[model samples]
Target: MSFFSEFREFAVKGNVVDLAVGVIIGGAFGKIVDSLVGDVIMPVIGKIVGGLDFSDYFIPLAGQTATTLAEAKKAGAVLAYGSFLSVLLNFIILAFVIFLMIKQINRLKRETPAPAPSAPPPTPEDVVLLREIRDALKR
Candidate 1:
C-alpha cells in the first residue's frame, strides 16, 4: 500500500490510540501532582521545616537575588538545584502513591486461590450391580 495509508493504519491501531490517551492523562496527572506539591503540600512542609521556602531554597551561581522562583525567572537568574528538589518531592510522593496502589492490587490478587477441578460423578447403581453379576457369571 501507499506510505500515507500505512501510517494511517498504524495510527488507528488500538495500542497506539491507548498510548496516546495514556500520555494525555499522564500529562494532566503530572500537572495536578506538580500543583499539589507547589501549592498545598510544600507549604505545609515549609511550615514544618521552620518556614523553609522550597522555591527560594535555590543557590545562585552568580549570587543574584531574585527572592522567589518567579522573580528569579523574571530577573533572568541562574537557577540552581532547588527547583529539582521541589519536583523531586512531588515525584517521590507520586511514586509512593503508585507503589501503594500496586501493593493493594497485588494483595487482592493473592486473596483467592484458584479452585481445583471437581471429581467425576459416581457410577450408577444398576450399572455397578450388572458388572458384579457379570463377573459372578464368568467365574
Candidate 2:
C-alpha cells in the first residue's frame, strides 16, 4: 500500500480516533479544572485562611525582601512554595473527581442485568432408546 493510504488507515482507526477525541476533551477539562481551582475553590480557601493568596506565598532566596511573589521574583531569585501548594490542591481535586466518576461507572456496570443462560441441546435418540430399554427391564 502507498504511504498515504497506510497513514489514513492508521489515523482513521477507532482507537486512534477515540484517543484524539479524548485528548481534545481532556485539554478542555483541564482548563475547567484550572478555573475552578484558581477562581472559585482557592478564593474560598484563602478567605477561610485570612485572605492570604497561596500563589503569593514564597521565600526570597537571593532577592530583596518583598511582600508579594511577583515583587519578590522581580527583585531576585525566590522559592515559590505557595504556587506549588496551589498546584497540589488542583491535582487532589482532579484525582477525587476522577475517582468519583470511575466509582459511578462501576456502579452502573453492576446494575446492568446479565444475559440469560441458553437452553441445552436435545439428548441423542440412542440415549433416549437406552433409557427406555432400562425402564422396561426395571418394570
Candidate 3:
C-alpha cells in the first residue's frame, strides 16, 4: 500500500479521532480552569488573605528595588511567586475535576446491568433416542 493510504487509514481510526477530540476539549477545559482560578477562586483567596494581589507579589533581585511587581521586573529580575501560586492552584483544580469525572464514570460502569446469560442449545433427537435406549437396557 502507498504511504498516503497508510496515513489515511491511521488518521481515520477511532482511537486517533477520539484522541484528537479529547485534545480539543482538553484545551477548552484548560481555558475554563484558568478563568475559574484567575477570575473567581483567586479573588476570593486574595480577599481572605488581606486583599493581596498574587500577581503583584514578587521578590526583586539585582536592580533597583521597586514597589510593584511590574516595576521590579522593569528594574531587574523578580521572582514571581504569586503567579506561580495561581498556576499551582489552577493545576490542582484541574486535576481534582478530572479525578471526579473519572470517579463518576467508574460509578456509572459499576451501576450498569450485566448482559443476560444465553440459554444452552437444544439436544439432538438422535442423542435423546440413544440415551432412552440405554436407559431401557439398564432397566
lDDT of each: 0.85, 0.91, 0.93
lDDT of 1 by residue, 24-127 (tens): 98889889999999999889988998998777776655566877766666666665576788889989988987899899999999997889898989999999
Number of the top candidate by lDDT? 3
Q: Compared with the true structure, what per-residue lDDT tens digits does model 2 show for residues 1-139?
A: 9999999999999999999999999889888888899899988999999998888889899856799988999989999998998888889988999899999999999999998887998999999999999999999
Candidate order, TM-score descending: 3, 2, 1
Candidate 3, 1-139: lDDT as tens digits:
9999999999999999999999999999999999999999999999998998887888777765788887888888989899999999999999999999999999999999998888989999999999999999999
Instruction: Compare candidates 1 and 3 on TM-score and give the better one.
Output: 3
TM-score of 1: 0.70
Count of clashes, each model:
0, 0, 0
The positional error of residue 66 in candidate 3, measured at the CA in angstroms, is: 2.5
Ranking by lDDT: 3, 2, 1
Clashing pairs for model 3 are none
| Candidate 1 segments whose C-alpha is farther than 4 A from its true place | 70-79, 111-115, 120-139
In model 2, the worst 10-residue window by lDDT is 62-71
**What lDDT does model 1 reach?**
0.85
TM-score of each: 0.70, 0.81, 0.89
